[model samples]
Target: MAGPTPDELRSVVDRFPTPPDAEAFGRADELLDGTYSAIAESWYPELRRLATAYAEGDVLRESVLEHVEAVPSFRISEGATPLTRRREALATAAETLDSVAEVSAWYDDLRTLLADSPDSRSLLERLLHDFGYAAAHVLFLGASSPEQVVRRLRWAYRTVGVRIDSVSSEAGTERTTFTCPYRDVAAGRCGKRWVCHEKLDRVDDGYVTYLRERGIDYQRPRGCAESERCHSSVARDGPSQWWPKTPPSAVEREP
Candidate 1:
């Protein structure tokens, strides 16, 4: 597939709530952009090295790239209520880490299987496990807070098997209907701390008006490039005029 268009990427990102502060968003954007760049730049070389060791050659490299390119974008607006905001942030973080972890696990397995000889299998297996752990750690470190990262990573791994068929399918309903342990309704860490079980509704005129009152800018472009620009702007200067009026907060708080 031709890599995800900017629009597709934005659609993924637009699903999550924005950070409460411009700096948070900026840092998150930087981390995301850097992660994307690192994968784009190093994945091929790393794949090539691993492929050579396993004798799979470029085929493995190509496969990995195809998988990475297939990842859907995810984003959420910060217009949600505080409870919703917390839940969305946790969910978004967990999902993002899960994607990276899954990819890492797959690569590790491939690497182990490709070992040059039977003698290499043990070493390769260890290496692969380390690699997978490292990949997850990289994501965790890039997150806004270490505690949040750890919590979400644990949640993501535990809930890996659950599935949501489609966003459009779930858009009109409340999150309580979902039957996963990770669902925010179970009075667990996520339920008590995040709002994962909140309902989602269409952005009606009233909601839009609310956003306007808050000074959030909502005129998002439907195209890919423009969408990237929109994210870039928010990453740099916070949201435009259509989101809630809460000003961006500082990055470091004792909390």
Candidate 2:
């Protein structure tokens, strides 16, 4: 008989018992480190799936596996926790969704995972940052009508207990305001209060970039992360037209 081929080897490895015990988790850690054969790359997906099957449920196996695989090798910090790494991976996956249906499906998985893992505040912030950009691109970039856009955005956030207060347009101007779920949802996750504020700021930047790309003017003044209530406004006119309408701030007035 021929020596075990890669597929045969993989089959045998897959058959290895996957129990929810310390030893299995240790095996996962070893597998993640490429401790087995030289064909570690090929085994990664299967290992992730097995790991998920052992930890979470079978339904989440694929989603969790995809989430774990999305993290490029360079992105995983040397000392980061596995949970942190997985969350970042999920952010990359969630942000790359190309359609409304895809985005909705991702949000469903993410919402449930976040609720079950409350200590994942930092991860939640990362997801929201990417999600804001994705949402803006999908809704504001001709994917849906303004009404549908607002409704979809509201629905996504509501799944996580966050409310999108307003999304409206008037005389070629659009403005939106919403409460920051991170404030309540991620209260004890971080060591400092300012860290939470920083997270909000970053997410707002993603939103602002989305509007800026489409020649829309975003009118949120100062840092939004500092405020419990976040808000953003956009004018339909291009950047050139929007720039002249607003009064100059003290920074701009300085000699």
Q: For residues 104-190, what per-residue lDDT tens digits would candidate 1 score against the true structure?
A: 344334433322232432443334434544454443444443233334433443354433221111222111111233323443532
- lDDT of every model, 2 decimals: 0.30, 0.41
Question: Please, what is the TM-score per model?
Answer: 0.19, 0.32
Q: In model 2, state the lDDT of residue 6.
A: 36
Give the top-scoring candidate (TM-score): 2
* Overall local distance difference test of candidate 2: 0.41
Tens digit of per-residue lDDT, candidate 2, span 156-225: 4576565677677886555577775565435455322233343554454456567666555555422232
Model 1's lDDT to the true fold? 0.30
